[model samples]
Target: MRCFIFVVFLSSVAAWSEPFRPWLIAAYGDTTNQTDRYQMGNDNTVIDIYTNLMWESGFLNVSTINLANKNCVSLFKNGYSDWRVPTVHEIQSLLDYVNAPGINEDYFTSLPSNESVLVTSSSSLQPTDLVLVVQQQTRSISSQYPPDMNVRCVRGPQRTAPLDRYTKFQYADKNFVKDQATGIGWMTESSAIWFCDQAVDLSQVWTPTIKALFSLFNQSNSPLIDEAVFSLPSMLYLGSSTPVAGENGYLWAIDGSTGLFQTVPLLGPAMAYCATVQLD
Candidate 1:
């Protein structure tokens, strides 16, 4: 009886020691290069051909499974089906250990896009995916000031006219210059606001609120203002990078004149704000 018990214990230990495997694997046609274009999906939802191929032909299936939809989850209602929306935690886990050397580069290489790279943290007990979702929710809240607070105390009047005349950077004709100091592309204010991608972090591109943009103009050649910047909606940012093929992306702009922001769908004219740090 003692020996039988010992054998069972050993089996349990072995099972526990085994590493977990992801449902998907890298199949043929998956490429890490960002320049090559290829077709994905069977046919119906045929989106544009991507430069890199993240072919999903392995143990796991890669379908657009919307976790928010009960019907979508119902489609995979079975044991060991091995398909679901990647929890924010799972996505983060993929990001954390993925960049390490000697890891399975093929798996990371086969992902749909570079933006899908995950960043996991050990401090949180919750799954990385859940953590990400919570963080995003909090960020969204912070972006827009709370409605319950008294508007007069927090709100201020918008400044009209260009705060100051400053040189703006133009990306149109491939006129690019590498600034030795901050490494950011230098440009002047076109309107009151000067919209551009954040050089420090590309994942989060920012646009200055009209108030903040005006402040920069006020500073002019003296120095830029020092404050946290806000971003336009994600749809606008994505549309700026990729041309809006079919439908225009929607965004909400705060208009201080009316004290009410308006939601509008747009294909272009989204902007970002920045500051200048003098290095001498």
Candidate 2:
């Protein structure tokens, strides 16, 4: 019944801004106004106090995306009938990358004690062919032949990230092209590799997160990013926003070829791409 403008402090993510931040800030919580975001609601439901969205704590195991979609909408949970499948980004909001199973167990205490991926509404490169999963790691799965993946529904005002509003505008000679939605300026690089300590030489260093990549870069066609800006290398990119617990200055290596990431020790001179974060 009210609105609040908040800043989402994504630990190591710097590309997200504006429209996406409102919804995303709910995930990471507002550093400016911190509170217990996830709280117990009615039976089998968890309320995100920050997002004003209720999440289905009890998950369903479905083999196909169609089944997952059907189950969420039809079932009536605690008098709420607006439940539906969540996008890959929506699922990523709940991923606690540092922990096993990758979900915060404090409020979401119903995680199945089995290795299973969660289904998302967003489709992959080929529609109906590939369905991406959101877990500790994001991987493509056969939409139809999936092995009983998990599905968690949400009931809230539906609003997607305003990522399609990428407008190329020039400001003097610097930052000639930029994604207007987010105040991030993508720096193009070739086979050059850089370390985290290389930030002193660069404007600002930020490691890409799976959630940020899932929202901004994953294109329908060939090249992962906008080819006009770059023909991105298929090598591991340096730095990650999500660090493994107990490992300081350590992060995941993003496979540029498929956008797949895994937590490993410095993947040897990763091809670097820089983005300067411009705050509003």
Q: Which candidate is the best by lDDT?
A: 2
Clashes of each: 18, 0
Q: What is the C-alpha lDDT of each candidate?
A: 0.22, 0.48
lDDT of 2 by residue, 75-105 (tens): 6877776676665445556665555555666
Candidate 1: misplaced stretches above 4 Å? 1-33, 36-182, 186-239, 243-264, 267-270, 273-280
**Per-model RMSD to reference:** 20.1, 9.3
Q: What would you estimate as the lDDT of candidate 2? A: 0.48
Candidate 1 lDDT score at position 29: 15
TM-score against truth, every candidate: 0.21, 0.66
The sequence of per-residue lDDT tens digits that candidate 1 reaches over residues 88-135 is 212222221112331133332222221122111111112111111111
